[model samples]
Target: MGQGLSCATTQEHGLFSAMQSGDLDTVKAMLERDPSLTHQTTAYDRQSALHIAAANGRIEILSMLLERSVNPDVVNRHKQTPLMLAAMHGKIGCLKKLIEAGANILKFDSLNRRTCLHYAAYYGHSDCLQAVLSAAQSSPVAVSWGYARFVNIRDGRGAAPLHLAARQRRPQCVRILLDNGALVCASTGGYGCPGSTPLHLAARGGSLDCTRELLAWGADRLQRDASGRIPYLVALKHKHGACAALLNPSSAEPLVWPSPLKFISELNQEAKALLERALMDANREREKNILKGTAYSLPSPSHSDTGADDNISEASDTELCCICFEHVCTIEVQDCGHQMCAQCTLALCCHNKPNPTIACLNPPVCPFCRSAIVRLVVAKVKDCDDADQDIGEIGSPKMRKARKSRNFSSEGSSSFKGLSVMSPFGKMGGRGSGRMAAENEWVDKP
Candidate 1:
């Protein structure tokens, strides 16, 4: 709300309606009779006709408003100028017109402290972002806010346009910001970031494409968050195995730094232990079957939940998902060994993206250890009743029937198949260094 808004009459409600409907002729005739109508604002939000025209991308109406020299920089209650509304709504044409009219590209929304480029990037408007970038070029005199200055400007959350685009899973916008020199690794630990890089955000978001784009643009894969998690760790904690696969140290070509030696040693130890356990379980089952003559019946063995209050889950369950304590634990997180029912795990991974359109945007994290879940293994624990029929040891690979499992070859995984249970961390996220356990760290234990 600015100059001439107070004195202008609002009795002509027809002007508002006409502009809203894009009735160009009606607006033209009314404006000819009373050229001052462009300066009047709506009674409620104090949004002038220019604001409405720009917000709705009324190109013809906007051109007419600019012709009258209506102040295009005027902001409404939220301190959102017309350019901000245009950028937020993906109204590229309106944005172009505003830039042509000398609207300040540097003015930010008062509430979020976001420049117009942040709005465009957050909403995934690549073209709108380009328009804002090209604004400094079209100006009469030179402006300080060039392509370099605008793309990297942080909001109240210290989130550059790149940060906004990365979190929102706008890969194209992210690329544009980076191409224009936006800092890819800027940290925003507090606000939306929760203390991680844009790559970390990309990992949590579960967009493999976005993660790749960030990585290709020099996003650090090994950079740690406040919790000492690299992007790969973040992905693992969140059950996005596919994401972890992209950044897993085991798969990538050698890094210049060779990573912390302790991680490698722990992974080796964890793999060895898992292989031993799985081999022992397999031998026990074979011996039991041979002694019982394959069909000889043995009495079912009864067992009770051990250490029910260990204050932790150790690849074990209580006949139920630990989170809900209701349904039988049918599914086990592959690497970390958290056993929860499929219903609970699926709900957790998909809560952020239930709809198919945005499903690929979010990767699920583990409910217990916050590790990225690479795979889910489904197998029934052997009960004494298995002696009555042809049964493999409860933990044997033959007894395991994988459902939705990507890789069952690792022994470190809850689902033992061709390989042993092993992880990057020695005992599922390290031997209790003030860290929650139960994440399979050795994704690659060949």
Candidate 2:
């Protein structure tokens, strides 16, 4: 009884020491005597020999434990497998060995529900996270559990790997996560880091590089969290002015966003729908006024026949629109009596592209007067054809309110780039506004 007890004690002490110091020879010899010892865990936390070798980055000892008989997925008291330890320490070589040995990369700790990816991300271990993601993508069995799942996997706090990486100021990890299909604008909901996105967390962490990476990847700068705070606002909240400066767009730098084409397409659709409706209404009003014959005032009778007279030609030249210099200036900007051809006015309101700089965008301004145009008036010419001439105009009643505090580049944006800024008011707008050439009389706007 005494002799067997001594041998067991010797074996236990030798195994613990060998595992602690990464003694390859002693570990090998002990395994030779009894391979079953490979499955045993220490008294504390139930960490096995594999856990020890992995935590210590012992490639050779780790390889033997993995190859001999150690369970790669064996859980400690905390429910973290050897893979989790390897990932936390950023043991790249040991991480690769365990992955090849078929370690469960998706295992999470019982306490925090954190996956190996989360551990790698929290520590900014881009290399380890990449390996786990690569393995999962390659495995045919991982089709349902692909990179999308791993990259976005959140812990108990509802924080995804990206959120952790961003909060920790891991720029490379942020780039990797974004490149691997991580949702850039995903918010940390109520349960976890509430109302914070990766960008928000990056801002809070005050890492300019991380903030730039998020922005470059198309993160919404104006995405509001639960507290109604945008990412840029969050940066300011934490007193990260440099980060906020980058987020703040300026006229000097050209604005480019992640989905420039998409934003443009959506805005154009909205402008077309609203403008078409306004145009349709204005046309009906124009036709109604025309039927009443108050639509136009008769001009003084001119010399009949093709005029070769210099005075007649000179009279025609005075009516030519200044902007186009070819068409008549039928519409005039409110307040500022600047005039342009109705056709040019329509095109101005219907411009489709974002003005590269918000400050330089002058959709609501009269090109000639440089004054804020409130509304537009289209004067009816006695002989002008309703079907041929542009008959519709835009209203700017709401422009002052929407434009005053507008940030066109913000996530929830408001722009009337292609839509005419002039609001149509039929004949009411004709009084004292832009005048029809020659008569200088206020006329019904089309």
Candidate 3:
């Protein structure tokens, strides 16, 4: 019996070794010689050949194992499926193969009671995360568990994937989860302290980008955890001055995505991106004001108005927003056709605080035409050569003034980047009143 046990252990070791090293021929030969080898697992962990291949990113080996009818959903000692291992290790190819082999995505591990989705988010493997989500869309999990429910699925500690992503400071993963409908303000039971929202976790983790994404998706900054601490307090506790500035409820309110509006929800991809960017930029402006004269400084903005592509066009052809006299007019008000810079448009919408009792606030009016703002779309800008024709039409003096601000870029943000010295609403114009008071004073009128 001892000799027999020794022989079996050696065989299992050889097979697992071949799979880990991606030795396709050796793995194939071993499997063929002893068909039971396909089902064999390591001694202690009970991790099978499939788990080894998937964890090590042996795509061809993984394919052969799957073809040999090795169960892709086979669990190890920890009850972690091959799919979970693939996701945890960020083996995208292996993960997809396991999914194709009908590996279960909803299988929870014994360690955390967390599914493959939670593993992906916890480890910050966005590609693996996306693959798992895409597979779940068509898999039986969607029907039995519901896609939204799976997205917000909790672990033993009641931490959702969004909670993991935020705690780990995975901005891209957080954004992906939020886009897939992970509850932004969903409270936890024990994860990251009881009743902590993703926002609270993000603050505790000191991730400005993650915090921004949550806030853009309408995360309530005022929501407190069981510890009776808001995200702002969490940021302060962690000494994340930049994140704390943005999370401060006393700071100017950032513009949300306005998802409640049917028209807004129906926007095209490009239009939606413009609006989201506008919202982020507007919030960054607020953060700048709060951090001014402080020890902390924000990192530079991601995208910029001035790029190699901008050099292809003449500055003269760009029509400046007459209201701001700063940025190029990018958003067009439909029917009326009045145009404004994204920042100005966002300012108009966010000028007044929405009543909490009301489900949806009335859409703001166009400052230019006094028309009810309806559908907004990306405006077509004139190409470089059309400069002389429309230069006067857009007001040459305003265009010239815009050039000055364009010459001064704020940490490589945009041609018209002036958040340090300007309000998001350009017309606010150093009104001496605080940002909140300045926003309150602005009246949309004909």
Predicted structure with the largest TM-score when compared to the true one: 3
Q: Candidate 3, after superposition: displacement of residue 80 in Å? A: 1.2
lDDT of 1 by residue, 25-48 (tens): 999999899987777777756777
State TM-scores per candidate: 0.53, 0.54, 0.78
Q: Report the Cα lDDT for candidate 3.
A: 0.74
Clashing residue pairs in candidate 3 are none
lDDT string for model 2 (308-345, tens) is: 22333333444544444444455655455455555445
State in Å the error of residue 97, model 1: 1.2
| Model 3 spans > 4 angstroms off | 1-9, 306-318, 322-325, 332-340, 348-377, 381-424, 427-446
Q: Model 1 misses residue 156 by how many Å?
A: 0.9
Give the 10-residue window scoring lowest on summed lDDT in candidate 3.
432-441
Per-residue lDDT tens digits for candidate 3, residues 241-350, read: 88998888877666566555556756778777877787776667667777888887766578765552354335444455655556666677766656666766666654
> Quick one: best lDDT, which candidate?
3
- Superposition error at 168 for model 1 (Å): 0.7
